[model samples]
Target: MTGRPATTTLWRPTGPEELALVRALDWRAWPPRLPEQPIFYPVLNEDYAIRIAREWNVPHSGVGFVTRFEVRSGFLSRYPVRRAGGRTILELWVPAEELPEFNAHIVGTVQVVHTFR
Candidate 1:
């Protein structure tokens, strides 16, 4: 696929508050598909996506800056090094049409680095 540069939002969890956001994002992104697990899945949800974007704008209380990159489809598989680093993170892929909401869920989680261009 063609490649292009796009901006994304990221967040670094520092404390409980940050962690809570991550948890919340996880829940939103992947709301409980089953009754038993409920909010434990890793699936992507529209609401969660929006939350990620919102969290990206907030100030992080941990190391490294939450960064997002909008690239083509092959970008992720090609640039593993640049995306490497940090611990305890979550990510989700959103279609271009739902980018706004997807971004919200991304930032709310832990450290986010999006690549959708």
Candidate 2:
């Protein structure tokens, strides 16, 4: 095996409020999901994330951000990938309670790859 850890790239479309919380965590982890939100979805592709950030998040919050990160493949395998719409619109449905465990498997710091306003 190579020295690098086996990981899968994931992207999240977030609003300013959520991005601020991520920043407060030093970009190391995502904040806990609110009670009403039962799932924490991280999309499989950047295109879907960008679409959400621009279409949904921007309209709701006035600004949005697309963040990318990597997570250990082994840790991610326990959860099934879900297709929300088109073929490319795929995501991992991590239950809110399991989010802490999910965060623990992140391979590196989360990054803001794109922003929309």
Candidate 3:
């Protein structure tokens, strides 16, 4: 083994309001979901995230952002990858209550990789 820490990359498409909450956390963690939101989804591919940010988030909120982050590979294994639509539309569904544990497995600060207005 190369001896580097194992991590899996994930992408999240977010609106300005949600982005604000993430910023409030110093980019170290994602904010808890609202009462009606039962799951926190992070996509497995950047293209899927970008599509959502541009088409969904921007249209609804006037601004959208695609954030990328890494999580410990082992910790992520418990959540099976889910295909939302096409083959590339893959994501991991973390239950709302598990978000704190999920945040703890993040390998680094969340980063904005793309933005749409």
Candidate 4:
């Protein structure tokens, strides 16, 4: 196994603002943000995901959703980490053109963990 850890190392929790993008994707995955938004921010825990969904998304759009998915641990080293208001958020700096490649690293289907409406 190349001596790599046989374990799922990272699960990113996200609140997709574009619900349609989530529905339209193959894995219910979040499509990469626009080129203008070069950083794809995914938090490290479900609680923070839920909080963003409930606090920001629901209030702004009257609907909120939280999704969780496993990603290749090897990719973690490429990004920078930030602590935001009690949340551990990872900054995946994927330019818009490279999104397809990023999506391919996801290990499984993205699961919608919660909905606040």
CA lDDT, candidate 2, residue 22? 97
lDDT of 3 by residue, 57-87 (tens): 9999999999999999999999999999999
Model 3 RMSD, rounded to 1 decimal: 1.6
Regions more than 4 Å wrong, model 3: 1-4
After aligning candidate 1 to the native by TM-score, how far in Å is the CA of 31 from where it should be?
14
Q: List, in order, the clash count of every candidate structure.
A: 19, 0, 0, 0
What lDDT score goes with residue 65 in model 4? 79
Query: What's model 4's lDDT at 61?
Result: 81
Summarize candidate 2's per-residue lDDT along 1-117 as a digit string, tens digits: 569889999999999999999999999899999999999999999999999999999999999999999999999999999999999999999999999999999988999999898
Best by TM-score: 2
lDDT of 4 by residue, 15-49 (tens): 45465676788663567677577667767666777
Candidate 2: list runs displaced more than 4 Å: none
The CA lDDT of each predicted structure is: 0.34, 0.96, 0.96, 0.64
Listed per candidate, the RMSD to the true structure in angstroms reads: 14.6, 1.2, 1.6, 3.4
Q: Runs in model 4 with CA error above 4 Å?
A: 1-17, 87-97
All candidates' TM-scores?
Answer: 0.21, 0.97, 0.96, 0.74
Tell me how far the alpha carbon of residue 26 in candidate 4 is from the true structure, in angstroms, after superposition.
1.6
lDDT of 1 by residue, 8-116 (tens): 4333212334335545855333222233422221222333433433464233432222222233333333223221223333443333444334434332333344312
